[model samples]
Target: MDVSSTLVFAGIILVLLWLFSVNNSSKHRLPPGPRALPLIGNLPQIDSNAPFKSITKFSETYGPVVTLYVGRQRTVALFGYDVVKEALVDQGDDFTGREQLPFMLKATRGYGLGISNGERWRQLRRFTLTTLRDFGMGRKGMEEWIQEESQHLEAHIRSLKGQPFEPTFLLGCTVSNVICCLVFGERFNYEDKQFLRLLNIFTEFIRFNTSTMGQLYAIFPWFIERLPGHHHTVFAQMDEVREFIKKKIQEHKETLEPNSPRDYIDCFLIRMNQEKDNPSTEFIYDNLVSTVMNLFFAGTETTSTTMRYALSALIKYPEIQEKMRQEIDTVIGQNRCPNMEDRKSLPFTDAVIHEVQRFLDIVPFSVPRYTLKDISFRGYTIPKGTTILPMLHSVLREEKQWASPWSFKPEHFLDQNGNFKKNPAFLPFSAGKRNCVGESLARMELFLFLVSLLQHFTFSCSEGPDSINLVPEYSGFANMPRMHDIIATPR
Candidate 1:
């Protein structure tokens, strides 16, 4: 209680912290990587523009598991299927923590399902999956929603009358509408100004996250957030979406039914009331809003971007697209709407869709994981608090698994008999516990949307198939396919 006693206690705490850091740093045999400088720490060595390639090249030299320092943060990079699988699958328990990413932390304020760890994460993730499933995410009811949405998409595209138009917002509107139906309990019109603005904001948020500035913000957030930039704009834009979610939550509270919850928000509100008397419940206002934002933010752009990328792929490879159409036509014909059941019957179409996802490698740097404690991986110890990149780009493009890892090949998912085959390394949704919860929904969306589009129209670009580039226009957090204007000739 005395001044000297207080000073002595503080001294012991600092000493313990110092000793912990020193012991972890000096004793642990870290994975081999480029040596770091004092403060910069390998930032100079990493290619900011195409960091994933730089990482892949680094893995080639340093082996599958490599250590790198982005800013002062000590991070481990896992490359290839064996190393990534070994950590994410075999060592799943040791690698379940999601780092409090500064960008996401700023947006969600560490309240959402995505940015949470431990108890909060477990609770939110369990509740989110159950709530979403109950509302027909990846179920027959949801398939009906997507099927109806596909008809709207067909009409929207057909209204273009075989003329050229950018499919970015079209894909976004269509995709966001599905999540809207699930979360908000209603779909927004494709031409709604507010809805379009929200979609644009989501698109902008993703673009910023995939830019050099976005990576810089992640590394130096304190400085980045202070300076004038689009990060502020992105945050403000996110506020609009959050405010919109809040408004929906209020509406749900006004008319929520106990037994018949309509959507994700409604179910969450109902559960919040159920857990109101419980002291340890995670069902509060902050978690509700953030979790809804998590689902809406995640469910929208990733699948839409992948769908847009598939359009590019289809445009690039007309023969493959045409063949897929033949398979679709044979399976369901142009009149009937495609469903999840149709996925099996239409093997070639399924193969093409899978190939598009595999080739796109959307989230190249799977949201970085954190070590729960000092964990040993492949004879190397990743220190606690270290950011871990499982490098999904490596898994999706690992040469050991895929025959042609670099090329866009539907045969990658096809057997010699042309039946759809599943490869263990096709990990666009990633693997293990923290793998995408919306995997089933995204898969269903890709199949139903793409099949429906191909059923009605033939996709083509003014520049022709030769001009269609499959390479991503940007690559940092996500590998966004280059945007293109294409015409759809109604079949």
Candidate 2:
């Protein structure tokens, strides 16, 4: 066949596939959603920039549980805390499947804990959780790690001498170094060129993933991959990060001590050997490399971005910042670094941090879940292979859940007695068995880093608080807070 003939053939194949998908979906009592086109599905209806907003709007018309298609992929989005909690928390196992988006598949090459399902996911997740806990993931040892890192962060800021600087990469360095200490067993210097390069890659990775082009790429990767665009550049940079991880694995192997495992890499290397003979063992070379990549990527970007947003939030609401500082001074004083033990004594400070996470709603759409098999949810049949989206944004911002769903109010997490209160709907880390593995660590970092920063410096931008917008610049894959150059004046 000539090129034109081949193109026609491919087009016909896609039509047939889309028709088959529609025919099957019609057979089942799928949830109601907006009308969709044949090949493109509901793309025309969606705001490509903020795809979740489109999904949320669909829920307003179709009720809480609604279905839509994105480039022929059927998706059922659960809105509100009740419905999302029922699916992800109530029927957790059925919603445990992680959708391996083409973007993630390309990033991990189909071999990581972040984008795997079934036995692979279970094995790696169990092992990862166990190993991380052993290395003090959410425990006292990790608290010390964060406390020490806080000092380093504070020192770096003090060296700035109150000059205005964008906190994006500097905060990335701070957060990434903590995960580096856990995974690689060492921290990178703030000025390391390669370290800075890796951090930039992570920032770009999040930026692209949250862009409109990135959304299109996820929905129609087969077509997008064939065409030239920014996606290619993002993927290439991702490969560089992956290659960097592989090199680190090699170094760990060379310096391995079976009896004295230095960090996560050493521990995994030891496990890989113990299971080298077992065919079913998930502890293998590819998994180790990919899981490390998963850890590095997840452990670095999300927490760092949250901290970045937290700084923006603080700058935007200096009153909240001052209140938190007062609480910090009273509870922990300025003599020593803030610790997790100080959280209870510092209720207002704790409330502000929790409120920050809740208001930001960073991961608005929890990593899309997949139905591994036919399942019944809310009297509807979610057919196997359908993507499930528990809209964390709706839950976090649900009118019925919060007194001020849209505003940044620390009192949302506070009681009439002025003690810190826990809200079931405050799911910034999400809720479920498949929720963020690094939740505890992220919490520790936010508290320690923010408290430490406020202890020494008052955050304000040159453009003034009025110029700082708490609204994220992008709102798709993640809610990315607008970046600003701000001064950290010595307190």
Residues 159-267, candidate 1: write the lDDT tens digits.
9899899999999999999988888889988899999999899889888988999999989998787899778999998999889989999999989888888888888
Model 2 off-target regions past 4 Å? 1-13
10 residues in a row with least lDDT, candidate 2: 330-339
Every candidate's lDDT: 0.88, 0.90
Candidate 2 total steric clashes = 0
Q: List the residue pairs that clash in candidate 2.
A: none
In TM-score terms, which candidate is top? 2
**What TM-score against the true fold does each predicted structure earn?**
0.95, 0.98
